[model samples]
Target chain A: MWRIAIYETVYIIIYGLYTVFEFICGMFEYVYQTVFFTCHEFLFPSEKRARLKELVSKIKKKPKHLTVLLGPEDAEVTDLANLVIWCLASQIVFISFYDHKGSLKKKEEKLQLEVKKHSGDTAQVIWYTDENSNLENGFKGSKVHVKIITDEDSKMSAATITKLLVESENEDFTIENIHKHFVKQFRFPDPEMGILFGKDYCFYNYPPWQMRLTEFFRFKSAKSITYAQFLNLLVKFSQREQRLGK
Target chain B: MSWVVDNQLTRFQKFCVNVIKCGPIPRHIAIIMDGNRRYAIRNKMGKTEGHTKGFERLAECLLWCRELGVKEVTVYAFSIENFNRTIEEVDTLMSLAKEKFERVFEEKDKIMMEGIKIRVIGNLSLVPEDIRILLAKSVLLTKDNDKSILNIAFSYTARDEIVHSMKTVVEGLESKKIKPADVDADLISYCMYSNQSPDPDILIRTSGEVRLSDFLLWQISQHTQICFTSVLWPDFSIWHLLGCIFKYQRAFPGLKKYADECQSNRKKLNDRITSFLGDIEKKRMEQMEIYAKT
Candidate 1:
């Protein structure tokens, strides 16, 4: 009778204990999702951390020359900014973001504050997106040299303005932008960037100068993205075979 | 050395001359010869006959790729997903493989003498044992071929290649020589079966599918993708390939493609998180099982 009682007790503890353990796991998952995913909750799951931690081995303090293209804001502009910050923090890679904060002249004037605040002491390109602009107070000393993406003699599309920002004057890259005036500035490239956060095949034509052979990665939506998601993209990217032009 | 020739000339005699002239092209031009089933049903043939016809066309096209200066050519002969077909159909495919490999062996095609290697890519373990042995011997006999590389993607899926690569990386990571952080696109590419060759410069797919259908997913990023609608793959000619190449050459001057930004670390975490709880539906389900059981 004592053995039977002990058996029953043991059985109750084993399976019932498993049930409690499962209950705790469910609670942990709920807490993880609600806190980390829903709120700016700090503790990330191991799977989520796997990609970034994997890249920790390949951090380049100073990689080969880096080219930065400033993009105009639509909806996901801030997302792009966070991405840049994350990219920069991960390595001392070369970066040049934009001077154009908003379209309004006054807002654009005040936009230098965000540039100054975030740029700290980074290389910058404060070139005007248009052929000519009256520059006076707000645009005085943005340490990096400013080069005009479009000249008066050579008009270009608005969508391709950002590509023109690449320092190298690859004619093939610039030719596509000569006449196309796009409004948004950051759209899809020929081969879009893998970590892009935008919809539509329509490239807003930022700097049409630099995009000679850009890989295009399109996102139908960027509303619910997190830093961890960006890392995941890099992980997927690392597995790609970049067979450029045969 | 005129690279541009109009293969669509109305004259049949003109077609013969053009075929003779098309040479010095890329040695290994792989084709995703899709749309056999639909083509067969339209022609009032059953699906099984459709595949046999497709097989015939494939054999014929190899002769064309060979004649026109292509040393090696690959065809997406079967996809892993295609295993979902009826067992009878799969049996028919195995029979076809046996017969085809036997014919290639019996004829002692000059290609074998010239050192053209015949490889069956993708998960061949799923194939029947006998068929696998025949494939093994074909590969072995042609292993030293320097003339051309012929890859048949039987039960192939590109994304699965990536997943397979990731699993391989875990093994590499365990060895401590390959740090997890050192894993990048180039590293992964170098480890793949096709890493020896440059990614196919021109990926030609028949049946007018806009999407790559997971064909050569990792290898192709900036290659010229050619999709044809009117011509069924079996009926495709070497002229068809040349015509598309000419068009690609013309478009080259205008369309610009870019390489990816090389990175060391951490972007993976961000992208992974954003993509899901929604990637690799199979593994995710398994992981969900753990969490659900809890």
Candidate 2:
């Protein structure tokens, strides 16, 4: 009985200590991230621009298509607009914003306006779902093409695509042809990188079909996403090697 | 000499695990086991030897998971893209897989006693006949075990799984059994190879890789906790798994909230879709029947 009591006591003590340690570490991380974000925010516009440019230069390879997965807390239009402007500055051709609730999609016009305000008059922003958006044109004149997706898009696309295939005269369904249909439906290439802004690491039903090779980077919260952190993700993405099962 | 130390270490590990069991435990876990070749190179061993070590590590991890009360484990054993590797390496991997399956079959009694069901997910037609037969037999042998599930993703890719589900849906539509309106996210999910299990609570990828690498893309929801560690597959230890579980527990409350919200939203969407389909349901069914007859 005494031995069992001693073992239980030891277990409790160790577990308690570990939990406390984890709490302390989490607090430290929160403090560090806040301080880092504030430091970047305090930088002069010119200095920040220079820093962004430097970071972009350091990236040897950049993803042409980027998807941002936003948590409920991070679904602010202004923050998304800032992200779009940053992507435009970095020359990413395609950007997709995914929020599970479709809140961002509802505020698309506001997001577009905010992006345009920061991206300048010369930068053309094309919404992929717009009637004028042509898949073949492929960001020819547009500085960046944006697509705002929600859970509905993923579910609807699958149903719609399946219906199209079933209705079509062709009996054969190959991956190549199915992929073509999806590309046509999406009007954007598959995302090469996915940036998640949330307290937890979850995709929230970000399009499964397009994320086969997407390298995901996570930020603690999307509310105060800094340019430096964004640039760092880009650099990290560039450095990582993808074997694609080779 | 080492047996004594190992026994003592296992006792300590049991104590740790018992304490961990006091918290919220993940019901399902997925793993992307990577970096075998790198581990081999680092240790100056043959690549095959590293793979063997990785398999050993998997056994250890599964034991730990079972002790920790995880009911389902899905492992990325092989990918469809892995067929592009050198012929010799691919051959070795197939043989290794066959040998492992045979061993599992030989230990069927033990597996049955443990109530562990074995499932091989993915495009099985792509594998060789002999290995396919072995996998089928192993799955059959353990099909009745319901306490736990071990999903081995062989010849699998998320895209292919999606495509497979699409093909199934197409077949259903062609047969006039289900109309186009019947197809939805839940339908696609049901047709997926992993339809038997719930979405994983934790996804751990070894070797510091940050990508999903075409593993369970359709099933990963906002509730899943993803952990990427730098440790290679052969070097992965119980501590790493415990750490992952610890993180999951720490984030469980928030994850549960999001999961509940998603579930409710999905229910609402399904209701809306059903209501929307109600108006045109007859016409779609008639059209589907006409198409099927033709």
Candidate 3:
């Protein structure tokens, strides 16, 4: 009984010491993180662009397909233009864009011209929601393909697909059939990397049919997006070994 | 630290709580509590100890959610793939689960008093029969409670859930209870393991893991705001949750619009199916009336 009491006392003392030490460490960590985050918020815009550029140049393996999700407020023609230039420079073969409100029609012409001018190599641009053009004419021949996804397109495709499912043979509609319809309707490439340019890490219902296994990277703001951030995201994605839910 | 410092920390936490409560908080939050084993390794403790600490943290987190006014919280407690681990580890986990479930039963009165509803989702058949019984008992005890919900995903995977849902639909069809025209997104969703709760508005994955690991893949991938943190599950704090809420608040407007769009899409599909069903029902009623007259 005495031995047991002595052991318990020693254990209690050690445990108490550990708890106090952890508490002190936690306080220090909290203070350090708060200061660092505050400073970064003020200096991130200017420093991040240069760091991202350096990181991009260091990346040896570039992602084949990259998708960018623009916040409702960040969906500007100029931002898209910068993205196109960065993609062309990095040799990222395919880029897809989705705006929350789906208002890219007014910027299509300017976007196309900007891409043509900035795209040193050949590239094909298609509006996924374009009613006049069929799938055959959409991507006839191009080294790079850019598709602008919109809400209207998704709604139309969803209606047609649901109609097809309802008409199909008894309760046999499965994931494959739904997936096939989505692929045929949207013709989207499976993006290996997805970059979200906003504070929140969300897809915002952007082409939900794809992006099952895409690696997502969140940037603080989309207002002053730099190639470096894009490059950093790519490098980070390349380093990741996606288990794909295995 | 001195009492003054501790008081200041509490004040700061309260301030953050006030700010988070100002905006539209997420109705449902799903968490993938990862990195317990890593925490064990880092802290030089046994794996079981890490899990025990994680459980304690989870209990604290549930109380935090209750205080934060979060209605529903679902946690990825165990994945279907976790069964593939070494026999010893699996045994440990099963026993742990049994103990936790038993504890729930032991605390039935307190749980009831708190209005907590505990639900265990996933295929219970795969669990040890004894643990499964304990789980069911806890769930039964908490069945009437409605203040808050806690969904524990055990031996669960989103694909398995989807497959099970599909099987349910197929069975319904085979029995002639459901027509091909009646099948829609909402119907399929209702058959999922998570049908008991609404789709998570915000998802959190801890331990620096960016992938979903097959948690709620079909439900929340489109519209849910996800926050990934490097903190181990045992180390997760209310401050981390608050930061995530701040992020969610910033993105809520766009997310809400997207959610509205998805709802409208589902509504349109449902409307089409409903009209078809209405026609069929009308014909069936007419035939029944004529037969009755005869």
In terms of DockQ, the best-performing candidate is 2
Q: List model 1 lDDT by residue over A17-59, tens digit each.
A: 6568867986886677567675443454565457567665443
Per-candidate Cα lDDT values, in order, are 0.48, 0.79, 0.71
Give the CA lDDT, 0 to 100, for residue A195 in model 2.
Answer: 89
Candidate 3 per-residue lDDT, tens place, B125-222, comes to 67777776676676667777899999999888775676566556555555566677666556666666676678898999999877677678767756
In candidate 2 the C-alpha lDDT for residue B124 amounts to 77
What ordering of candidates by TM-score runs from best to worst? 2, 3, 1
How far off is residue A92 in model 1, in Å? 38
Task: Specify the highest-TM-score model's number.
Answer: 2
CA shift of B237, model 2, Å: 1.1
- Which pairs clash inside model 2? none
**DockQ pick, better of 1 and 3:** 3
Q: Judge candidate 1 against the unseen true structure and give its global Cα lDDT, from 0 to 1.
A: 0.48
Taking all chains together, each candidate's TM-score versus the true structure is 0.47, 0.86, 0.71
Instruction: Please tell me which model should have the higher DockQ, number 1 or number 2.
Output: 2
Q: Score the docking of each candidate (DockQ).
A: 0.01, 0.50, 0.15
Docking class of 2: medium
